[model samples]
Target: MNWQPAKKQNDYVQTRNKNFSPPTVNQVLQNAQKMIGPISESPRLDAQVLLAKIMKNSRTWLVAHPKSRLGAQEDVQYRRLVARRAHGEPLPYILGTWEFFGRRFQINPSVLIPRAETEHLVEEALGLLRNNRSVLKVLEVGTGSGCIAVSLLLEMRSLGVVATDISLQALRTAAQNIVNHAIGDRIDLVQTDLFSGIRGQFDLVCANLPYIPRKVLNNLQVGRWEPRLALDGGEDGFIYLRRFIAEVAKVLAPGGSVVLEIGEGQDEEVRSMIRLGFPRAPVRISKDLAGYNRVVVFET
Candidate 1:
């Protein structure tokens, strides 16, 4: 009995466990890069940005903290975000915010991500409003994420906006952004189809409505995750464009400006619509940095 008990105790003697090596920032990023590199245009940068967002640190900090190990939960969350990005979900939707006109606005799949090209429209509107003090009120049809409205108000303090969206969820998103920028009182939100429930006339009407054609959308990723109600523009990509043009005259003020962000090669048709809607108004076409015919300004 003594020999058997002593042998069992020695066989079951405790052994120290080896130290666990958690995933370092560098290892995590490299793995993410391999997953995202195949799909994303800027895989490395995107990986860094997503990780930075998850870690609540800047991308620059990620560069410096390459050896730093992520906690178990952070690694899981970061990997999830990378998977979404790998699936071709827009970066802004994954990150929940995007820079438009030098300001970060709350964004999601409910609205179209504010395009850098759209900023050309904002800059054009700001430039037009700079000299004139008479343009006090604005109307943004299909306000989406309220990027255009919020940006306009932030840059020009004298303006008030009536942002209308057909989608209530979109209105909620826009409203959050309005509150985020503390411009609730300066802006009024209405859930109505183009100019349906809107009563007052706006001095400036900025509409970045759905201009992408339905036929071409199947091949593009713009509407894959974004709401089709916001991106599908019917047969010629001008269905809503036509409707907005037909009815916009009722809400536009005299000498009012309508600044539109048009898709590539739609400038001609947009000019035609503006000319048909407001015959007396002159249409000014401004190209983006890439030299695409982007922003169209029409004065009524």
Candidate 2:
């Protein structure tokens, strides 16, 4: 349980291999199976990933060489990662990078961590872009970690994107992802809240703004580690959604669409507000894998 700076990477890896405690692969698998559905649903897979990361090897390589002894440094690193995971730290934060939409994205504490639900937004957006193959102007509000924006750019490399965030720190992190992904020239990162500093009309506007009510945020599991600005959505949690609906009409191109990631139980209200604000804007609700209404699309 004691944390220490890694003396040497390989030394840590070796220690993890020798001190894993589980007697056999089956034992390790059993322990992982038991851990799943409690803290993390993918405990078995997470174990392999954490072990592979510590071993500085691919997941396939780790699977192929599970019994291969780790060097001293690799063992220590594996134990450190496991200990962190045993607490509540996310695996992506520990690995420092996560795969999103078939591409690698660097993640840090500066921005809200990306989630699977948000990927639904990406899927819907891509569907929209595919339907309209023309070069499109896209804007992503609250582009934390640039996960959504970067993924869009990577998915639709030919389009131009403008990604905005209220936090300079988040923008910095997002900018890094842009550059790292080699899409620096294709997308722009602006430091602004919503579309305050943005100009012109975009064919599509995407926002995954904070939608957690101030009251509920404190009790949410995500509130423990994520930035409050990314979760606290005022008293009712629809403050930002309402405001976005009000202002988006002015900035949206004729026949353009707006994609929003909504919070649980707020989809109906959000869709209603979007309709009331932009009566001409066609509003539709989309659900996630869990069958929750998680995305709202507004066509102007």
- Best candidate according to lDDT: 1
CA-lDDT, candidates in order: 0.84, 0.79
lDDT of 1 by residue, 1-300 (tens): 011112222332321214544578999888888888878889999999999998999999999989998875676577678878877887889999999888888988888888889888889988878868754988999999999999999999889889899999999999999999998888899999888978988888888899889999878877688899888889889998888888888888877778888888998887887787778877899999999999988887
For model 1, where is the 10-residue window of minimal lDDT?
Answer: 1-10
TM-score of 2: 0.85
Model 1: residues with Cα > 4 Å off, grouped in runs: 1-18
Name the runs in model 2 displaced over 4 angstroms.
1-38
Residue-by-residue lDDT tens digits, candidate 2, 174-253: 88888898888888888887778689899999999998999988887678767898889999998888889888877789
Write down the TM-score of every candidate.
0.91, 0.85
lDDT of 2: 0.79
Query: How close to the true structure is residue 160 of candidate 1, measured as C-alpha lDDT?
Result: 85
